[model samples]
Target: MENVEQEFLSVIREYERVIYKVCYLYTTPNATLNDLYQEVVLNIWKAFPKFRRECKISTWIYRIALNTCISFIRKEKNIPEIVTLTQEADRSEEDDETQAMLQQLYRMINRLGQLEKSIILLYLEEKSYEDISEITGLTVTNVATKLNRIKDKLKKMNKED
Candidate 1:
Protein backbone atom coordinates (compact mmCIF):
# COMPACT_ATOMS: atom_id res chain seq x y z
CA MET A 1 0.00 0.00 0.00
CA GLU A 2 2.80 2.37 0.85
CA ASN A 3 4.56 1.57 -2.39
CA VAL A 4 1.38 2.21 -4.33
CA GLU A 5 0.91 5.53 -2.58
CA GLN A 6 4.49 6.57 -3.41
CA GLU A 7 4.08 5.54 -7.03
CA PHE A 8 0.87 7.51 -7.34
CA LEU A 9 2.56 10.58 -5.89
CA SER A 10 5.43 10.24 -8.34
CA VAL A 11 3.07 9.97 -11.30
CA ILE A 12 1.10 12.97 -10.10
CA ARG A 13 4.29 14.98 -9.66
CA GLU A 14 5.41 14.16 -13.17
CA TYR A 15 2.05 14.84 -14.82
CA GLU A 16 0.58 17.53 -12.60
CA ARG A 17 1.22 20.29 -15.10
CA VAL A 18 -0.51 18.41 -17.88
CA ILE A 19 -3.46 17.77 -15.61
CA TYR A 20 -3.59 21.43 -14.65
CA LYS A 21 -3.51 22.51 -18.28
CA VAL A 22 -6.50 20.32 -19.09
CA CYS A 23 -8.40 21.59 -16.09
CA TYR A 24 -7.61 25.19 -16.97
CA LEU A 25 -8.89 24.71 -20.47
CA TYR A 26 -12.09 22.95 -19.46
CA THR A 27 -13.22 24.93 -16.44
CA THR A 28 -15.25 28.11 -16.47
CA PRO A 29 -14.67 30.89 -13.92
CA ASN A 30 -17.81 29.85 -12.06
CA ALA A 31 -16.34 26.39 -11.76
CA THR A 32 -13.38 26.27 -9.46
CA LEU A 33 -10.37 25.07 -11.44
CA ASN A 34 -8.76 23.69 -8.31
CA ASP A 35 -11.88 21.65 -7.62
CA LEU A 36 -11.58 20.05 -11.04
CA TYR A 37 -7.87 19.46 -10.50
CA GLN A 38 -8.57 17.76 -7.21
CA GLU A 39 -11.29 15.66 -8.79
CA VAL A 40 -8.87 14.51 -11.50
CA VAL A 41 -6.27 13.63 -8.91
CA LEU A 42 -8.80 11.63 -6.97
CA ASN A 43 -9.97 9.82 -10.08
CA ILE A 44 -6.41 9.04 -11.08
CA TRP A 45 -5.69 7.56 -7.71
CA LYS A 46 -8.90 5.55 -7.75
CA ALA A 47 -8.22 4.25 -11.24
CA PHE A 48 -4.50 3.71 -10.79
CA PRO A 49 -4.82 0.13 -9.65
CA LYS A 50 -6.65 -0.76 -12.83
CA PHE A 51 -4.28 0.96 -15.20
CA ARG A 52 -2.97 -1.64 -17.57
CA ARG A 53 0.39 -1.02 -19.19
CA GLU A 54 -1.29 -1.06 -22.57
CA CYS A 55 -0.59 2.61 -23.27
CA LYS A 56 1.75 5.40 -22.27
CA ILE A 57 1.15 6.84 -18.81
CA SER A 58 0.67 10.31 -20.26
CA THR A 59 -2.09 9.03 -22.48
CA TRP A 60 -3.80 7.49 -19.50
CA ILE A 61 -3.45 10.70 -17.59
CA TYR A 62 -4.96 12.67 -20.47
CA ARG A 63 -7.89 10.28 -20.68
CA ILE A 64 -8.63 10.48 -16.98
CA ALA A 65 -8.22 14.25 -16.83
CA LEU A 66 -10.42 14.87 -19.85
CA ASN A 67 -13.09 12.51 -18.57
CA THR A 68 -13.12 14.15 -15.17
CA CYS A 69 -13.35 17.63 -16.68
CA ILE A 70 -16.17 16.57 -18.97
CA SER A 71 -18.08 15.04 -16.09
CA PHE A 72 -17.60 18.10 -13.91
CA ILE A 73 -18.82 20.39 -16.67
CA ARG A 74 -21.93 18.33 -17.13
CA LYS A 75 -22.74 18.44 -13.43
CA GLU A 76 -22.16 22.16 -13.18
CA LYS A 77 -24.24 23.35 -16.11
CA ASN A 78 -26.17 25.76 -13.95
CA ILE A 79 -23.06 27.70 -12.91
CA PRO A 80 -22.80 31.22 -14.24
CA GLU A 81 -20.50 31.47 -17.24
CA ILE A 82 -17.33 33.48 -16.86
CA VAL A 83 -13.90 33.43 -18.42
CA THR A 84 -10.94 34.69 -16.48
CA LEU A 85 -7.52 35.53 -17.88
CA THR A 86 -4.49 36.67 -16.03
CA GLN A 87 -4.28 40.40 -15.52
CA GLU A 88 -0.75 41.62 -15.75
CA ALA A 89 -1.44 45.29 -15.96
CA ASP A 90 2.18 46.24 -15.39
CA ARG A 91 3.46 44.39 -18.44
CA SER A 92 5.10 46.18 -21.34
CA GLU A 93 3.16 47.12 -24.49
CA GLU A 94 4.38 44.09 -26.43
CA ASP A 95 3.51 41.76 -23.58
CA ASP A 96 0.05 43.27 -23.40
CA GLU A 97 -0.49 42.62 -27.09
CA THR A 98 0.60 39.02 -26.68
CA GLN A 99 -1.68 38.62 -23.70
CA ALA A 100 -4.60 40.01 -25.64
CA MET A 101 -3.99 37.52 -28.45
CA LEU A 102 -3.82 34.68 -25.97
CA GLN A 103 -7.05 35.79 -24.35
CA GLN A 104 -8.74 35.84 -27.74
CA LEU A 105 -7.45 32.35 -28.53
CA TYR A 106 -8.74 31.06 -25.21
CA ARG A 107 -12.14 32.61 -25.87
CA MET A 108 -12.36 30.78 -29.17
CA ILE A 109 -11.29 27.54 -27.52
CA ASN A 110 -13.94 27.94 -24.82
CA ARG A 111 -16.51 28.05 -27.56
CA LEU A 112 -15.58 24.57 -28.78
CA GLY A 113 -17.53 21.44 -27.80
CA GLN A 114 -16.09 19.07 -25.22
CA LEU A 115 -14.58 16.58 -27.66
CA GLU A 116 -13.24 19.32 -29.87
CA LYS A 117 -11.71 20.90 -26.79
CA SER A 118 -9.85 17.68 -26.01
CA ILE A 119 -8.74 17.24 -29.62
CA ILE A 120 -7.39 20.76 -29.96
CA LEU A 121 -5.67 20.59 -26.61
CA LEU A 122 -3.85 17.45 -27.67
CA TYR A 123 -3.11 18.96 -31.07
CA LEU A 124 -1.65 22.07 -29.45
CA GLU A 125 0.54 19.80 -27.37
CA GLU A 126 1.85 18.40 -30.69
CA LYS A 127 0.56 14.90 -30.18
CA SER A 128 0.49 12.78 -33.32
CA TYR A 129 -2.82 11.82 -34.86
CA GLU A 130 -2.36 8.27 -33.58
CA ASP A 131 -1.88 9.50 -30.04
CA ILE A 132 -4.82 11.88 -30.27
CA SER A 133 -6.99 9.12 -31.65
CA GLU A 134 -5.98 6.78 -28.84
CA ILE A 135 -6.59 9.40 -26.18
CA THR A 136 -9.88 10.49 -27.73
CA GLY A 137 -11.09 7.03 -28.88
CA LEU A 138 -11.47 8.46 -32.36
CA THR A 139 -10.11 6.62 -35.38
CA VAL A 140 -7.08 8.14 -37.10
CA THR A 141 -9.23 9.23 -40.04
CA ASN A 142 -11.76 10.68 -37.65
CA VAL A 143 -9.08 12.56 -35.78
CA ALA A 144 -7.82 14.06 -39.01
CA THR A 145 -11.32 14.93 -40.12
CA LYS A 146 -12.19 16.58 -36.82
CA LEU A 147 -8.95 18.53 -36.75
CA ASN A 148 -9.56 19.84 -40.27
CA ARG A 149 -13.08 20.80 -39.32
CA ILE A 150 -11.87 22.49 -36.16
CA LYS A 151 -9.32 24.48 -38.15
CA ASP A 152 -11.99 25.59 -40.58
CA LYS A 153 -14.23 26.59 -37.70
CA LEU A 154 -11.47 28.61 -36.12
CA LYS A 155 -10.76 30.28 -39.44
CA LYS A 156 -14.39 31.29 -39.81
CA MET A 157 -14.49 32.50 -36.23
CA ASN A 158 -11.43 34.64 -36.89
CA LYS A 159 -12.91 36.01 -40.08
CA GLU A 160 -16.00 37.03 -38.17
CA ASP A 161 -13.93 38.97 -35.67
Candidate 2:
Protein backbone atom coordinates (compact mmCIF):
# COMPACT_ATOMS: atom_id res chain seq x y z
CA MET A 1 0.00 0.00 0.00
CA GLU A 2 2.81 2.36 0.89
CA ASN A 3 4.58 1.50 -2.33
CA VAL A 4 1.44 2.22 -4.30
CA GLU A 5 1.11 5.60 -2.64
CA GLN A 6 4.73 6.47 -3.32
CA GLU A 7 4.44 5.42 -6.96
CA PHE A 8 1.34 7.55 -7.38
CA LEU A 9 3.16 10.51 -5.88
CA SER A 10 5.97 10.07 -8.38
CA VAL A 11 3.49 10.07 -11.26
CA ILE A 12 1.99 13.27 -9.93
CA ARG A 13 5.43 14.82 -9.57
CA GLU A 14 6.36 13.88 -13.12
CA TYR A 15 3.20 15.37 -14.58
CA GLU A 16 2.79 18.22 -12.11
CA ARG A 17 3.33 20.97 -14.67
CA VAL A 18 1.01 19.39 -17.22
CA ILE A 19 -1.67 18.90 -14.58
CA TYR A 20 -1.35 22.47 -13.40
CA LYS A 21 -1.55 23.84 -16.94
CA VAL A 22 -4.82 22.01 -17.48
CA CYS A 23 -6.15 23.33 -14.18
CA TYR A 24 -4.99 26.86 -14.88
CA LEU A 25 -6.61 26.94 -18.28
CA TYR A 26 -9.86 25.58 -16.92
CA THR A 27 -10.02 27.78 -13.84
CA THR A 28 -13.10 29.81 -13.01
CA PRO A 29 -14.21 31.96 -10.11
CA ASN A 30 -16.55 29.21 -8.98
CA ALA A 31 -13.75 26.66 -9.33
CA THR A 32 -10.56 28.34 -8.34
CA LEU A 33 -7.26 27.07 -9.74
CA ASN A 34 -6.42 25.30 -6.49
CA ASP A 35 -9.86 23.76 -6.35
CA LEU A 36 -9.54 22.39 -9.86
CA TYR A 37 -6.01 21.23 -9.19
CA GLN A 38 -7.16 19.27 -6.16
CA GLU A 39 -10.02 17.76 -8.09
CA VAL A 40 -7.73 16.65 -10.93
CA VAL A 41 -5.22 15.10 -8.55
CA LEU A 42 -7.96 13.31 -6.65
CA ASN A 43 -9.49 12.00 -9.83
CA ILE A 44 -6.08 10.87 -11.04
CA TRP A 45 -5.50 8.98 -7.80
CA LYS A 46 -8.86 7.29 -7.98
CA ALA A 47 -8.28 6.21 -11.56
CA PHE A 48 -4.64 5.37 -11.22
CA PRO A 49 -5.02 1.85 -9.96
CA LYS A 50 -7.24 0.78 -12.83
CA PHE A 51 -5.19 2.52 -15.48
CA ARG A 52 -4.38 0.07 -18.21
CA ARG A 53 -1.24 0.61 -20.20
CA GLU A 54 -3.30 0.89 -23.36
CA CYS A 55 -2.67 4.62 -23.65
CA LYS A 56 0.17 6.98 -22.80
CA ILE A 57 0.27 8.19 -19.21
CA SER A 58 0.00 11.80 -20.27
CA THR A 59 -3.07 11.09 -22.37
CA TRP A 60 -4.73 9.32 -19.47
CA ILE A 61 -3.96 12.20 -17.15
CA TYR A 62 -5.27 14.82 -19.57
CA ARG A 63 -8.45 12.89 -20.09
CA ILE A 64 -9.05 12.78 -16.36
CA ALA A 65 -8.15 16.42 -15.76
CA LEU A 66 -10.22 17.75 -18.64
CA ASN A 67 -13.25 15.69 -17.74
CA THR A 68 -13.04 16.67 -14.09
CA CYS A 69 -12.82 20.37 -14.84
CA ILE A 70 -15.58 20.26 -17.45
CA SER A 71 -17.90 18.35 -15.14
CA PHE A 72 -17.19 20.78 -12.33
CA ILE A 73 -18.18 23.68 -14.57
CA ARG A 74 -21.42 22.00 -15.53
CA LYS A 75 -22.32 21.31 -11.91
CA GLU A 76 -21.46 24.84 -10.84
CA LYS A 77 -23.38 26.52 -13.69
CA ASN A 78 -20.62 29.09 -13.85
CA ILE A 79 -18.81 30.87 -16.67
CA PRO A 80 -15.19 30.37 -17.68
CA GLU A 81 -12.67 32.69 -16.08
CA ILE A 82 -9.99 34.71 -17.84
CA VAL A 83 -6.59 33.72 -16.54
CA THR A 84 -3.94 36.38 -16.09
CA LEU A 85 -0.32 35.38 -15.75
CA THR A 86 1.70 37.01 -13.02
CA GLN A 87 4.99 38.68 -13.82
CA GLU A 88 7.20 41.05 -11.86
CA ALA A 89 5.91 44.60 -11.95
CA ASP A 90 9.22 45.75 -13.30
CA ARG A 91 9.96 44.08 -16.62
CA SER A 92 11.71 44.79 -19.87
CA GLU A 93 9.71 46.39 -22.71
CA GLU A 94 9.93 43.26 -24.87
CA ASP A 95 8.79 41.12 -21.99
CA ASP A 96 5.80 43.39 -21.44
CA GLU A 97 4.72 43.00 -25.06
CA THR A 98 5.07 39.25 -24.88
CA GLN A 99 3.13 39.14 -21.62
CA ALA A 100 0.33 41.25 -23.03
CA MET A 101 0.00 38.94 -26.04
CA LEU A 102 -0.14 35.87 -23.85
CA GLN A 103 -2.76 37.48 -21.66
CA GLN A 104 -4.76 38.36 -24.73
CA LEU A 105 -4.51 34.81 -25.99
CA TYR A 106 -5.72 33.49 -22.66
CA ARG A 107 -8.57 35.99 -22.68
CA MET A 108 -9.64 34.77 -26.10
CA ILE A 109 -9.33 31.19 -25.00
CA ASN A 110 -11.48 31.93 -21.96
CA ARG A 111 -14.23 33.04 -24.28
CA LEU A 112 -14.27 29.56 -25.81
CA GLY A 113 -16.61 26.82 -24.72
CA GLN A 114 -15.24 24.09 -22.45
CA LEU A 115 -14.57 21.60 -25.24
CA GLU A 116 -13.15 24.27 -27.47
CA LYS A 117 -10.78 25.36 -24.74
CA SER A 118 -9.71 21.78 -24.19
CA ILE A 119 -8.98 21.27 -27.89
CA ILE A 120 -7.08 24.53 -28.21
CA LEU A 121 -5.08 23.94 -25.07
CA LEU A 122 -4.01 20.54 -26.31
CA TYR A 123 -3.16 22.05 -29.67
CA LEU A 124 -1.01 24.73 -28.02
CA GLU A 125 0.81 22.04 -26.12
CA GLU A 126 1.87 20.62 -29.53
CA LYS A 127 -0.14 17.45 -29.26
CA SER A 128 -0.83 15.89 -32.62
CA TYR A 129 -4.38 15.65 -33.82
CA GLU A 130 -4.44 11.95 -33.05
CA ASP A 131 -3.19 12.51 -29.53
CA ILE A 132 -5.76 15.25 -29.01
CA SER A 133 -8.44 12.93 -30.33
CA GLU A 134 -7.34 10.32 -27.84
CA ILE A 135 -7.32 12.73 -24.94
CA THR A 136 -10.52 14.55 -25.93
CA GLY A 137 -12.41 11.57 -27.27
CA LEU A 138 -12.84 13.34 -30.54
CA THR A 139 -12.01 11.72 -33.84
CA VAL A 140 -8.76 12.75 -35.47
CA THR A 141 -10.69 14.24 -38.36
CA ASN A 142 -12.91 16.12 -35.95
CA VAL A 143 -9.91 17.41 -34.07
CA ALA A 144 -8.36 18.75 -37.23
CA THR A 145 -11.59 20.41 -38.31
CA LYS A 146 -12.11 21.97 -34.93
CA LEU A 147 -8.55 23.23 -34.81
CA ASN A 148 -9.10 25.11 -38.05
CA ARG A 149 -12.34 26.58 -36.77
CA ILE A 150 -10.85 27.51 -33.45
CA LYS A 151 -7.98 29.26 -35.18
CA ASP A 152 -10.40 31.28 -37.28
CA LYS A 153 -12.45 32.12 -34.23
CA LEU A 154 -9.37 33.36 -32.40
CA LYS A 155 -8.43 35.47 -35.37
CA LYS A 156 -11.88 37.03 -35.38
CA MET A 157 -11.46 37.75 -31.70
CA ASN A 158 -8.18 39.54 -32.37
CA LYS A 159 -9.86 41.62 -35.02
CA GLU A 160 -12.60 42.56 -32.62
CA ASP A 161 -10.13 43.98 -30.16
lDDT tens digits, residue span 1-161, model 1? 99999999999999988998889887776567799999999999999999998999999999999999999989888763635554322235557678787777777887888999899999998999999999999999999999999989988887887
Q: What is the lDDT of residue 73 in candidate 2?
A: 81
Q: After aligning candidate 1 to the native by TM-score, how far in Å is the CA of 87 from where it should be?
A: 7.6
Candidate 2 to truth, TM: 0.92
Pairs in clash, predicted candidate 2: none
Stretches off by above 4 angstroms in model 2 are 79-81, 87-94
lDDT of 2 by residue, 1-161 (tens): 89889999999999988888888877777888889999999999999889998999999999999999888888876454576654322335557677788879888998898899999999998999999999998999999999999999999999999
Q: Could you tell me every candidate's TM-score relative to the true structure?
A: 0.90, 0.92
lDDT of 1: 0.87
